[model samples]
Target chain A: MALVEIKNVRKNYGTLEVLKGVSLDVEKGEIVTIIGRSGSGKSTLLRCINALETINSGEILLEGQSVSAKMDGLRQMRQKVGIVFQAFNLFPHMTIEKNVTLAPILTGKTDKQGARKLALSVLERVGLADKLKAYPEQLSGGQQQRVAIARCLAMSPHLMLFDEVTSALDPELVGEVLKVMEEMAAQGMTMVLVTHEMNFARNVATKLVFMHQGRVWEQGDPKTLFANPQTPELKSFIGHHAG
Target chain B: MRQFSFSDLLFLATALEWTFLMAAIALAFGVPVGLALALARTSGSAVLRTVATALIELIQGIPLLGLLMFFYFGIPVLVGKDVPTVVAVGAAYTIYTAVFLGDIWRGGIQAVRQAQWEAGACLGLSWLQQFVHIIAPQAFRIALPATVGFLVQLIKNTSLASVVGLVELARAGQMISAGTFQPLLVYTLVAAIYFTICFPLTTWSRTLEARLNGAR
Candidate 1:
C-alpha cells in the first residue's frame, strides 16, 4: 500500500472550488513534486494531504487510516506527518530549540531532556546546531527555513510536506534552503513538494504532477514530463515560464 | 487651601490600590474572554460570528456610563437584589474592556499569515493546538502593545466609578474640592496624579509597539 492515498478530494472556498475531485498516491520514501500556475490547486492539494484545508468531499488515508479531526486521528496521523511552510512560521516568542522541542515535549509526551536531545540532533542535521539559542527573527530567511525544517524533523515523521518553502527567500538565500532539502531527499525522506523551482523538481522528484484549473493535467516521471512534449498545456507551461 | 499634606499623599497612595486592583481585575477577566470573542468574530460559523459581532457592536455603541447605570439599576430590578456600587462599576468596565480588547485582539490574530494556519495543521496539530502553539503566541506579540494601552485606559476609566459612589481618585478629588472650595488646585493635583500613573505606561506601550513592528 502507498504511504498516502488521497481519494477524490475536493475543496471549496465559498463560491469558488479550488480543488475538484483530486486523487493521487505517494509511495513510501518517494519524492513527489506538484507544479501548477497560481490558483491551480497545487498548494491546496498539499494542504489537503496534511488535513490543513478540510476537504469538501473525499478522504485522505495515511497508511490505510483516515485523517480526521478526532483526538485519536490527530495522535496517529500527526506522528507520521510533518510540514514546512513558505513563510517559516517559527514561534516568535521561542528560541530555535524551543520551537523544535515544543511538540515532542507537549504532545509526544517525551521528557524535556529527550526532546532537547532530539531537537539538537535535527538542528545538527540541518547544519544549524550553533543556532540553538537564536530566535527566528535573529536568523536570515534561509536559516529560518532550515530551523523550521529542523523543527519538523524533530518529530521524526514518516512524510514531510513542503509548500513553496523557498518562495519567500531572497534569490541569494534560495540555494541554501534547496540544498538542505536536497540532502533530506538523498537521505530517503518522503516528501510531497509544491514548488516553483523547476531545477529542483527536474532533479529530485521521482514523480511530477501538474495541476491546472483544479484538476491533475498530467503525471509522469520528471524527465519524461519536463523533457518530452506531450500536451499543449505542458508545452505551453514549460515554454512560457523559464523556471 | 492647604499645602500638600502627608495625609493627602497617604490618601493618594492608598487610592493607587483601587486603581491597580480595578485595572488588574479588568484585564484578568477581559483578556481570555475577549480572545474567545475575537475568535468567534472571525469563526466560520455564521451564527456564532453574527452573535459575536452583535455583542461587540452593542458594547462599542453604548457609553460606559450607560452600562454602569444598567448594571447598577437594571441588575437590582432583574434579580431583586441590590448589587454593590464597586462591583457594578468593575463589571461595567470589564464588559467595556472585553469589547475593545476583543476588537484589538482580532486585529492581532488576523495579522498572522494564513500560511501559518496551514503549516500548523499540516503538522497534525488540532485546532486548539494551533491556537495555543502557533496562532496565540504570534497574536500575543501583536496584542501586547494594545493590551498595555488598554491597561492605561482601564486605570483612567476607574475614575468613572465615582459616579456609582465608589471613592476612587476622581471621587476623592471631588470630595476634597467640596470641602475646601478649591476646584482648580485640587483637580489640577488630581490630573497630575493621573498623568504620573499613566505617562510611563503610555510611553511603554508606544515603545513596545515600535519595537515589535520594527522587529517584524
Candidate 2:
C-alpha cells in the first residue's frame, strides 16, 4: 500500500470548488512536489492529507487507515504527519527550545529531559543549534521557517508536508530553507510539498505533480514532466515559470 | 456647621478597606467565571455560543446600579428576608465583572490569528490542549491592558455599594460631607484617595500595552 493515498478527493468553499476529484499517492521515501498557481488547490490538497480541511467527498488513507474529521484517533494520525506553514506559525510566546519540545512532551513521547535532548538534535538537524533560546520574532523569516520545520521534526513524523514554506521568505533567505528541505529529502524522508519554487521542484522533487483548475493536470518524473510538456496547460505553466 | 476633622478622614480611610474588599471579591471570582464564559462564547457548539452571548448581553444591558438594587432591594422582597449589604453588593459586582471581562477576553481570543489554532491541531494537540498551551497565552497578552483597565473601573464602581448602606469609601465621604458641610474638601480628599489607587494601575496598563505592541 502507498504510504499516503488520496482517492478522488473533492472540496468546496461555498460555491467555489477548490479540489475537484483530486487523486494522488505518495509512496514511502518519495519526494512529491505540487506546483500550481494560486487558487489552483495545491495547498488545499496538502492540508486535506492530514485532515486539516475536511474532504467534501472521497477519502484519504494514511498507511491503510482513513483520515477523517472524527475526533477519535485523529490526533494520533496527525502526530505522524507534520505540516509546516508558509507564515511560519511558531508560537511567539515560547522560546525555540520550548516550541520544539512542547508536542513531544504533551504527547508522552518523551519526558521533559528527553524532550530537551530531542529538541537539541532536531535544532541541530536544521542547522539552528545556536537559536534554541531565541523567540520566533527575534529570528529572521528564514530562521523562523527552519525553526518551524525543526518543531515538526521533533515529532518524528513519517510524512512531512511543506505548504509554500519558502514563498514567504526574502529572496536571499529562500535558499537556506530549501537547503534544509533538500537535506530532509536526501535522508529519504517522505515529503509532499506545495511550492512555487520551480528550481527546487525541478532539481529535488522525485515526482512532480502539476495542478490546474482544481485537478492534477500532469504527474510523472520531475525532469520528464518539465521537459516533455504533455498538455498545453503544462506547456503554458512551464513557459510562464521559465521567464 | 461642624468642621471637616481628622476623625472624618480616618473614617473614610477605614471605609477604603471595604471598597478594596468588594473589588477583590469581584476579581477573584469574576475572572474564572469570565474565562468560562469566554470559552463558551468561542466554542464550536452554536448552543454554547448562543447561551453565553445571551447571558453577556443581558448582564451588560442592565445598568450596574440596577443590578445592585435588584440584588439588594429586589431579592429581599422575593426571598422575604433582609439581604446583607455586602453579599448583595458583592454578588452584583461579580456578575457585572464576569460579563464585561468575558466579552473583552472573547475579542482577545478571536484577535489571535487563525493559523495559531491550526498549527496546534496539526501538532496533534487536542482542542483543550490547543487552548491551554497555545491560544490562551497569546490571548492573555492581548487582553492584559484592557483587563487592568477594567480593574480600575471595578475599583471605582465599588463606591456604588454605598447606596445599599455599605459605608464604603464614597458613602463615608458622603456622611462626612453631610456632617461637616464641607462637600468640596471632603470630596477632594476622596477623589485624591481614588487617584492614588487608580493612577498607577492605568499607567501600568499603558506600559504593558506599549511593551506588547513593541514586542510584536
Candidate 3:
C-alpha cells in the first residue's frame, strides 16, 4: 500500500471550488514535487492531505487509515505527517530550543531530558545547532525557515510536506533551505512538495506533478515528463520556467 | 470660610484606601471572568460567541454610573431588602471591568496570526494545548498595554462609587470641600492625588509596550 493515498478529493470555499476530484498516491521514500500556477490548487491539495483544510467530498488516507477522522484519530495521523508552511510560522515568544522541543514534550513522545537531546540532534540536522537560544525574529528568513524544519524534525515524522517553503526567502537565502530539503530527500524521507524551484523539481524529485485549473494535468517520472511534454499546459509551464 | 486643613488631607489619603479596595475587588473578580468571556467570544461554538457578545455589549452599552445606580437602587427594590453600598458598588464595578477587559482581550487574541494556531495544530497539539502554549503568550503581549490602560480607567471610574454612599477618595474630597468651602483647593488636591496614582500606570504601560516592540 502507498504511504499516502488521495482519492477524488473535492474542496470548495463557498461557491468557488479549489480542488476538483484530485487523486494521487505517494509511495514511501518518493520525492513528489507538485508545480503549477498560483491558483492551480497545489498548495490547497497539500493542505488537504494533512487535514488542515477539510475536503467537501472524497477521502485522504495515510497508511490505510482515514486522514479525515476527527479527534484522536486525526491527531494520531497528524503526528506522523509533518508540514512546513510558506510563512515559517515559528512561535515568536519561544526560543529555538523550546520551539523544537514543545510538541514532543507535550505529546509525551519524549521526556524533558530526552527532548533536549532530540532538539540538539534535530537542530544539528538542519545546520542550526548553535541557534538554540535565539528567538524566531532574531534569525534571518532562511535561518527561521531552517529552525521551523528542525521543529518538525523533532517530531520524527514519517512523511513531510513542504508548501512553498522557500517562496518567502531572499534569493540569496533560498539555496540554503533547498539544500536542507535536498539532504532530507537524500536520507529517503517521503516528501510531497509544492514549490516553484524548477531545477530542484527536475533533479531531486522522483515524480513530477503538473497541476492546472485545480487538476493534475500531467505527472510521471521527472526526467521523462520534463523531456516530453504530454500536454500544452505542461509545455507552456516548462517554457515559462525555462525563460 | 475655613481653610483646607492637614487633617482633611489625611482623611482624603485614608479614603484613597477605599478607592484601591474597590479597584482591587473589581480586578479580583473581573480578570478570571473576563478571560472566560474572551475565550467564549473567540470559541468555535456560535452560541457561546453570541452569548458572550451579548453580555459584553450589554455591560458596555450602559454608563458605569447607570450600572452603579441599578445595582444600588434597583437591587434593593427587586429583592425587597436593602443592599449594602459596598456589595452593590463592588458588583457593579466587577461586571463593568469584566466586559471591558473581555472585549480588549478578545481583540488581542484575534490579532494573533491564524498561522500560529495552524502551526501548533499540524504538530498534533490539541486545541487547548495550541491556545495555552502557542496563542496565549502572544495574545498576552499584544493585550498588555491596552489591559493596563483599561486598569487606569477603572481606577478613575471608582470615584463613581460615591453615588452609592461610599466615602471613597472622590467622596471624601466632596466632604472636605463642603466643610471648608474651598472647592478649588480641595478639588486641585483631589486631582493631584488621582494624577499620582494614574501617572505611574500610564508610564508602566508605555515601558511595557516599548520593551515588547524592542524584543520583536
Best by DockQ: 3
Backbone clashes in model 1, listed as residue pairs: none
Error of 3 at B36 (Å): 1.6
Q: Model 3: residues >4 Å from true position, as ranges?
A: A69-71, B1-6
Over 4 Å off, model 2 = B206-216
Judged by whole-model lDDT over C-alpha atoms, candidate 1 comes out at 0.84
Q: Give residue B88's error in model 3 in angstroms.
A: 1.2
lDDT of 2 by residue, A139-163 (tens): 9999999999999999999999999
Candidate 1 per-residue lDDT, tens place, A138-184, comes to: 99999999999998897888999999999999999999899999999
* Candidate no. 1 TM-score: 0.87
Q: Which residue pairs in candidate 3 have backbone atoms (N, alpha carbon, C) closer than 3 angstroms, thus clashing?
A: none
Write one digit per residue (lDDT tens) for candidate 3, span B78-112: 99999888888999999999999999999999999
**Candidate 2 C-alpha RMSD relative to the actual structure:** 1.8
How do the residues B65-141 of candidate 1 rate in per-residue lDDT, one tens digit apiece? 89888988898899898888767777888888889999998888898887676566666566788788888878878
> Is model 2 an incorrect, acceptable, medium or high docking prediction?
medium
The 10-residue segment of model 1 chain A with minimum total lDDT is: A67-76
Give all candidate RMSDs, comma-separated. 3.2, 1.8, 1.7
Error of 1 at A235 (Å): 3.1
Worst 10 residues of 3 chain A by lDDT: A67-76
